[model samples]
Target chain A: MHIPDGFINVPTVVVTSAVSAGAIAYGVSRANRRLGEKHVPLMGVMAAFIFAAQMLNFPVAGGTSGHVLGAALAAILLGPWVGVLIMACVFIVQCLIFQDGGLTALGANILNMGIIACFVGYYLYQGVVSFWGERRRSQLVAAFLGAWLSIVAAAAATAIELAVSGTSPLAVALPAMAGVHVLIGIGEGLVTAAVISLVMTTRADLLQLERV
Target chain B: MRYSFLDQFSDLDSFIHRLDPRTKLVSCLAFILAIVLTPPGRWQVFLGYFSLLLILIIISKVPVFYVLKRSLVILPFVVLVSLFIPFFKEGEVAGSYNLWLWQVSVTYTGLAILGNVVTKAWLCVLGLILLSATTGITDLLKGLEGLGIPRVIVLILSFMYRYIFVVVDEAMWMRQAWHSRSFGNKGLRQIKTLGNIIGSLFVRSYERGERVYVAMLARGFDGKVRTLHSLTFRKADFYCGGLWFILLVVTGVFLW
Candidate 1:
């Protein structure tokens, strides 16, 4: 899911860089207001956790390995603004220190994995949980759908980036990426659900925040 | 649950590690752009790129073996996909083979593409290892926030970092439980036990998420999220960042 540098082309980087920049600016402003004093260091630690998890990829089909995205988990646990910020931090570190993703494609990766996954996944999770009465079972379903959609959304966004960069024809990149990613999404959903369940049981108090 | 793996190298004072996360982030991005944008046939440029990253790796003081091992983890996936290129990539056939009724051909062009993919990917990974080894993950996220990264993504990363150790601990405990109940990996029943362990892990994680959420809310988490501090830019950040960016551009232009 972390597209290394040069996978997409030049023009796509330009566009995505701008879009990602805009989103980050807004997310930071929002997070400033929402986060309490304690959240500063806490968020930093949480960011570190996502970085580690992303590094832990389990083998999946089609010769690719998938890992937890942590988007839905972030948003449902810490609110959407913080969720997006956490992913941005992970993307930046992965590129600079770990090189898991491309520098030029940072914007694209943020948009795909950061924006789409965190914000989109959080809202969807909230919607489902609220709709189903916000019980334990509802939380599981919300985590599933939220995690599943984030992966698929990221796949769609990457396909568009490939198309814009003119890497392979859209005809090739779109379906190929989505097809493989759908299988990947199943893994993401399960992992997200597991993490959410773990937090729910040990510190159910922490999750009560989502309900409020 | 020890989770020091991410920042273990961050505290070692070094020049490369001292640069602002945003600066290093951009430089690496440019390096990747240069590699990915180069024509596939430019084998020399790939060599040049590899040498460049290798030089940085040495300067950063991270162990050669560690970087090599980390980068190699990506090889399996790359090889899995690229291996088939010789058979599927459309071009002049290098050779024909038969397995009973089935016939297939391998093409030189496909092999070239495979080589191209592997080299580019490897070069990119080397650069990342240098970055990860030099910067603490926490500082890196702050730098990202300073550079206008969205809050939600940053939040997601934060939780993942804090809890990965906990998750690993849980896994360890589950393994111990299984080991205690069984004599060894001696039978098919062990496999079933493993499956049960995985299933229970999933359920446990799902429940844990709720508790974390409640903890967050107790701290006054409105739907809106906020951060407590900021990443301040320093003079070294500018000079080092500018120098690296210029060098990358110069090298990339020459490659072009």
Candidate 2:
């Protein structure tokens, strides 16, 4: 999902980088509009929380552990733009100081993990919850679907990027990436659902703020 | 309920750790680009790149032991995916072996490819560990927002970050509770207990999400995102970001 440097072709890197940059720039501006002065501190605290949570790796079938991408989780909690920003920060820091992702490909990484995951996951979640007609079970279903689709959507988006860049054949890129991620999405849904539930049961009030 | 895992190392004071995330992000991007752009099989360039990474790791003040441990964690995953590469990566035969009524062959190309994959992955992870360790999650979010990430995405991540520890704690508590109530040989019974716990956890998480949404609605969250930009770039941001890119270019152009 991180999409390191070498695997992708040069043209894809350049184009995705440009597109990613535009999206991130737009995201920050949008975040600025949404978050007020008071909400900043709260948002910061939550950001820290997400960073920490991402470290906990849930075991997968092949003995490889996959951690939560947290795009959907952030969307459900803070809203999507902020969620993208949060991940962007994490990825940025990871790339610069840690070199977890390629710098030239930063655009693609953010677009895939931050923008697509955050927005897609949240709307799906919000919609599913809304459709369930105020049922608690509806939230779970929405969360499950939102999370599952968010991951797949990100995979699909990456496949498109890979195709555009001609990094790998789309047929190979789409299924290969999506297939493994689909399995990973299961963990994503479960973890996302579990976290949202804990927050609601405990300090549920904090999940919302009075918008002026 | 709060946990940043190994990323908590960012708490330490260091010049590299304090630099803006964009600077760091761009610099690392440059580093990775340089590495990837370089054609494989240049052993010296790889060595230089590794050395460069080592220097950054040292400057970041992350415990070498911890970094090694963290890097090793990914080794298993990488090995699993790439293990087949060596077996299936047809090339000039380096060695052949017969065992268990099957003949196995090793190729130099396979070995080379395996090394390439492993090295690239290691360098990438090294960069991530440094970035995560030096920068606080909160500030990192601000940096990303400032850099042009989408808000809807930001919100989703913020929630995940906030509630992840809480969720894990819940699981731990539930496990403890399960242990206290049951007193049988730990096998299928334990598995069954685990299943029950997961089901219950799922229910609770679902309920919480609803309450959270209701809370969201109460706060004027109309399925729309809003926020103010707080991460104003300082002079240091420019200095570092610029210097890093320059360094990356130099390395890419000269070394490779």
Name the candidate that leads on TM-score: 1
For each candidate in the order shown, give its overall lDDT on alpha carbons.
0.68, 0.65
Of candidate 2 chain A, the 10-residue stretch with the lowest lDDT total is A36-45
TM-score for candidate 2 (chain B):
0.87
**TM-score of the A-chain for all models:** 0.90, 0.90
Candidate of highest DockQ? 1
Off by more than 4 A, model 1 = A36-38, A49-67, A126-139, A163-169, A194-212, B1-4, B7-30, B52-65, B76-117, B134-256
Candidate 2 stretches with Cα past 4 Å from truth are A56-67, A93-105, A130-132, A158-169, A195-212, B1-30, B51-70, B73-117, B124-256
- i-RMS for every candidate (Å) is 6.1, 7.2
Residue-level lDDT tens digits of model 2 in B1-256: 4465625788898878878776775676567667766776776777777777788789878897787776653454344344344354356998888968867777887677666756766676666666777777766766766666555445655564555556557766776687678766353344334434554554455455556666766787755566666665679879877776676666666776
Compute each candidate's TM-score over C-alphas: 0.67, 0.62
